[model samples]
Target: MFLGLDVGTSGVKAILVDAEGEIAAAATTPLSLETPAPGWAEQDPEAWWAASCAAIRDVLARRPSARVEAIGISGQMHSSVFLDQRGAVIRPALLWSDGRTTAECREIVTRAGGEAQLRDWVCNPALEGFTLPKVLWLRNHEPQGFARLAKVLLAKDFVRLRLTGSIATEPSDASGTLMFDPANLRWSREMLDAVGLPLSLMPDVGGSAEVLGRVTPGAGKLARLEPGTPVVGGGADNACGAAGVGAITPGEAVSSWGTSGTVLAATAQPRVDPGLRAHTFCHVAPGVWYVMGVVLSAGGAFAWYRNQCARELAEEARDDILVDEAAAIPPGAEGATFLPYLQGERTPHRDAGLRAAFVGLSLAHSRAHMTRAVLEGVCFALRDSLEILKALGLAPAHLLLTGGGAKNAFIRQLQADVFGLPVTTVNREEGGAYGVALLAAVGAGAFPDLQTAVQRTLARRPPTPPNLDIHRAYEEVYDRFRKRLVAART
Candidate 1:
């Protein structure tokens, strides 16, 4: 058995997979992100480690420890985890979704010769969500904490340190830090100096399949694992997710709609979009590149509506309103439109000031109409990403769908119609965990390579075809969205 762990924003998940790639056991523990101020998102690194250990213990309790072969980790990207000389967490981790460093991002862009130099080095424009800006934010706001930093690591690296007493990160996770040069696959000294950070603080970069070290004896007792079980260097959640869905080849893509939405496309060459909308990062596949466009809120919009807007309906059903409410409305939400920018947005429009709004709502629209419109709006936002991918000349051959949103047939059909593509879900929806398991298996020499391991492990579901008439209707609506975005920008 191999253990795969995903340290997500809200929770830590541990999955035990047997040599045959079947799930033997799984466990999860909830966590929270702290918002000390507006646009500032933080999390206790100790909380992630504690939750992960508990989750590991729960999973191991269901299976024999001796059967566990290796461990792999996949986690949220771009979060800065600082540590002091005694290896204690210096402060709360600044998460990838945090938007408190806009001024720092602007400074980096200016020092790096504006957006052009940033694109030349990182293949994307500077953003407040990235690690460098967070580092700068700490430098400016918490000079005491910045001075005490002995090591600066990403989220997964922090967990790995707890598990193995080693500080290291994989290339895929490193690429998102904004200080790593994706083209060269190393930390960017030029950018680091520009940001006034020391280069020695970063961890050594490794491949996703490389085994960093074994679980320490102390960690073994806490998690009920073998003392010497190898731990592989896993990747950023999205990179592992791409591997999970078997979207390794060029022209293949993964369209994921979780709390946030992302459209990821594999490419042979690093290609930056002219507008710096989509981010280009090095893929875990080594020689390949992947471009990703992120939406801040996707399925969260529907959840918000269910909890905040349709409280009466939710109170009446209390348990079974999701399906009934979603089924009551027709496609396209009966001409109602929603802008899914509740928590601002990423990709195409990197504006933090923008707010979500429901447009074209009429008195005839019911609660179900608003609910369905929320779902459609999420898909339309994802379509914006797909359109950007197409413009970059990297159209996807097939889009593998994953996450909680893919479980709903109503939303799945909406995605198919909006993108006019064959949207397919994998048999297993746990993309990040599955991908980490594959990396562990590869590290254990169960498979010759990552690609073969993925081919053996990944299972596909039937494709959902787009409804041509509905797709045409979406084309017109999408055009309106495009026009509105352009007008807003101007």
Candidate 2:
């Protein structure tokens, strides 16, 4: 058996996979986020360690007799975890959704000469969510914390450190930092020097599936695993999620709508978006790269609507009630258009200050109409990146839909209608945990590489082809949505 751990924003999930790429057991432990001020998202690093251990133990308890071979980890990317010389966490880690670094993003671009030179160095623009800007925020706002910072690690790397006492990172997560050169597959000295930070603060970079270290004795007891269980350097959640759905080569893509939404396409090379709209990052699969567009609020937008307008349905554990309500509305939501930029956006707009709104709302519009529009808006935001991918010649034949919203037929159809493309789901859609488990299989010498592992494991359902009539209707609604985005700048 191989273990895979994903340290996510909301929780830590652990899964165990048997040989032949089958899951033996899985478990998750919930985590909480702290937003003490507007636009600031933080989490206690120690809580991550606690939740990871709890989840690992929960899963292992299910099959105590199973012999574990190796472990792999996947996690949310672009978050910053600061540590002191003693390796104690210096402060609550800044999260990817945190938008407190707007000024720092501008500062990074200025320091790098401009957005053009910044993209030239890192293959991405300076975005508030990226680690580079978060680092600058620390220096500018909390100089004392900056002085105490001995090292910085991405979310999963910190968990790996607790598990194995090793300091390392893989390229997939590193590429999101705006301090990594995806084209060169290394830390960008240009960006580092421009920010006045040292190379020593970063973890050593390695291939995603490489065995970084064995489980330490202390961590082994806590996780209920044997000491010396090998641990592989896993991947960022999106890269691992892409791998899980077998989006490992050109001509393939994935569209996921969790709290956030993203459209990812694997490429043979790093393809920088000239407009700096989409991100080009390293894939967990060696020698492969991917272009991804991020929507800061996707399913999250729907959840917010549910909490504010339909709390009873949510509290009753019937989110499908929402689907039933929204599905009854027409394709265009009766002229209502929702802009799901609640937490700012990362893709085409690159605007962290953008807010969300319902355009053309009136007394005639009900919660159901707005709900349908919210769903449509989320899918359209994903399509924004799909359009960019198409322009870059990285278009996939179809999109593989995954995440919390993918389970509902209504959402599946809504995505197809808005994107004007066939979409499908895979049987093994356990997100990052399943993908890292497969990576662990490769690291444990059970497979030659990730490509062979995925091809052997993945089985796709029939495609959900787009409804041409509804797709036409969405074209008009999406146009309204694009035009109304200006209203969200407030």
Clashes of each: 0, 0
lDDT, each prediction: 0.83, 0.89
lDDT of 2 by residue, 281-306 (tens): 99999989999999999978987888
**Which pairs clash (backbone N, Cα, C closer than 3 Å) in model 2?**
none
User: Mind sharing the TM-score for model 1?
Assistant: 0.95
RMSD of candidate 1 to true structure, Å: 2.2
Give TM-scores for every candidate, taking all chains together and pairing residue i with residue i: 0.95, 0.98
**Could you tell me the lDDT of residue 141 within candidate 2?**
91
Report lDDT (Cα) of residue 404, candidate 1. 66
Model 2 scores a C-alpha lDDT of 0.89
Task: Give lDDT tens digits, candidate 1, residues 350-433.
Answer: 876556788778999987787777777788888889889999888886688877667778667778888999899876767788
Cα lDDT for residue 61, candidate 2: 87
